[model samples]
Target: MERDFDTTKDVVTNEVKAKKSAQAKADAQLWVVASGKGGVGKTFVTTSLGLTLSKLGHSVVIVDLDLSGANVHTSLGANPSHMNIRHYFEGAKSLQELVIPTTYPRLSYVQGFWDSWTPTDFSYNQIQNLIPELKKLRADYVLVDLGAGALEAHLNLFKTADEKILVTSPEPTSIEKTYRFIEAYMCHSLKENAAPDAFGNMITTLRDHRQRTLSKPFSFKSYLKEQTGISYTFFEALSQKPVRLVVNSCRSQANAELGHSIKSVCHKYYDLGIDFTASINYDNAVWQSVKSRTPALVAQPFTPLAGQFLNSCKHLIDPEELRAVV
Candidate 1:
């Protein structure tokens, strides 16, 4: 495992600091992997996916952004004290200085394993600073495993990256939460720093009929259409954003259909983007990886589950031109 923080001053833009020599075109694409809720094999997928991608000859970095309960190390068999995000958080180094190589060849980890960092440790402004820094890491892929739900911090970080993957299982509750997650993101994104007023009467009507429990009521769609103030077309714009998903713990091709099912729900009701992604099968070794303190990709290389990890990467590989250094 080789971890190189020697970021060349080669790539410089208002977005980057002027560096010296041009480095190999960074296949380094930053990705935010999150689910509507926890226990969806987030850390497992994160660790395994990074290892698999690295094995494919792509340098991979996994940021254990499971902020409050960062279990990425436990799953990856990494030493908790072997220089992590805490080192950078404590003002001991720059982002480049904090990358920790993992057991997988060319794989590394940026851990936020410390729950004690608190809001005071790094201000909201600090997160804004860290975003670009992480983006500039010299690797083929940066997988950020966010804590569940759509909070201001989580959303900001996830949305800033090159791709946003909403991780969810196929269960009823998981599907509903996924919708709720989309609703929240789409609504917030639509406002564009403004407020969600429902454009007045239309919003009020929707709220009133939200749980009318009547035989026939104003549907959320009709509620939107009726609102002359709020353009339905504007809501459709969120569908154009760069977003996708990965259905975890899948069992078969039928299980793979969950992604499209959630896509249909979001497209029909919320009018959001849920295309361009992949899924992981229900592999028992995933549990073993968790229990045995190993990454499934590295632990069970020949399994069907390992193949899914590679598929997930293919689902997210970005364009070489967009990531080109300035």
Candidate 2:
């Protein structure tokens, strides 16, 4: 029988290097829409962002990978016959055949295959397995509304995204939770599955902070640095992948400015500058359409909020950005 073994270490290293080189050539813009916590209107942001992009004539597909509660269908007000990501994974249905067109002709969706994928379900290998199917869509933008929280699966989507949009409203509690979420997220992004003792200790410290009586002197930044200092690998990931912070539910420019504040804070720590784009006003039409199971853009395309979202799409896959440089 033939042996399944590598000829030599030199050959193995060369093969590994070649694979990385090949991967570098296969870059596609995967925009991951995520939040540290749920109920911050992440799905709405994902839907609007995809809708806006499609209107700009870019073939856009929003993949609802929210395994816990797959409501991208309800958000869009469409009753998909096959709302199952599991089927796609089991080879029962091809992703191409799974494309469910919405009110917007330019937009379509790939609903979550798994209805009960917990934190464990967001697997890099499983998600990677699905890419060839997604690649067939080959749109200018592949918008992914990753499941909520700071689970490895959620962070993986953030890790793999070409562009990341972190959304949050202005409520103080929401802001604080979002902060904790981002810090935990970035901490993990810099280091995936670190030592057991150290990881457990960090979680304990975070819990302690949450338990503190009143004064919250301890900071997440200090906590991370104390545990894991910036090293070669950390800096390398930061330099390669940066995130953009987006503020939604702006009652005024002050609400929009909150995004800038958050960006400034991230810059102070991460040395990355986040762009503040596309702030939408409090539109009752959003909820109204939700009751009727309709996408706000389709139900009220002419709303001011709708215009802001489409304008965001214009900037997201800007035509000028795609123009070849001489």
In terms of TM-score, the best-performing candidate is 1
Predicted structure 1: lDDT: 0.69
Q: Name the runs in model 1 displaced over 4 angstroms.
A: 1-27, 115-123, 193-241, 252-254, 318-326
Across residues 84-186, which tens digit of lDDT does each residue of candidate 2 receive? 6667777787776777777666688887744454453756787766655665565656788887777776776676677778888888877887677677666
Looking at model 2, the pairs that clash are 77-293, 84-113, 85-112, 85-113, 86-113, 86-114
RMSD for all candidates, in order, please. Answer: 8.0, 10.2
How well is each residue in 201-277 modelled by candidate 1, as lDDT tens digits?
A: 54455355545643563445555665545556544544555567788888778888888877776666544456747
Candidate whose lDDT is highest = 2
- CA lDDT of every candidate: 0.69, 0.71
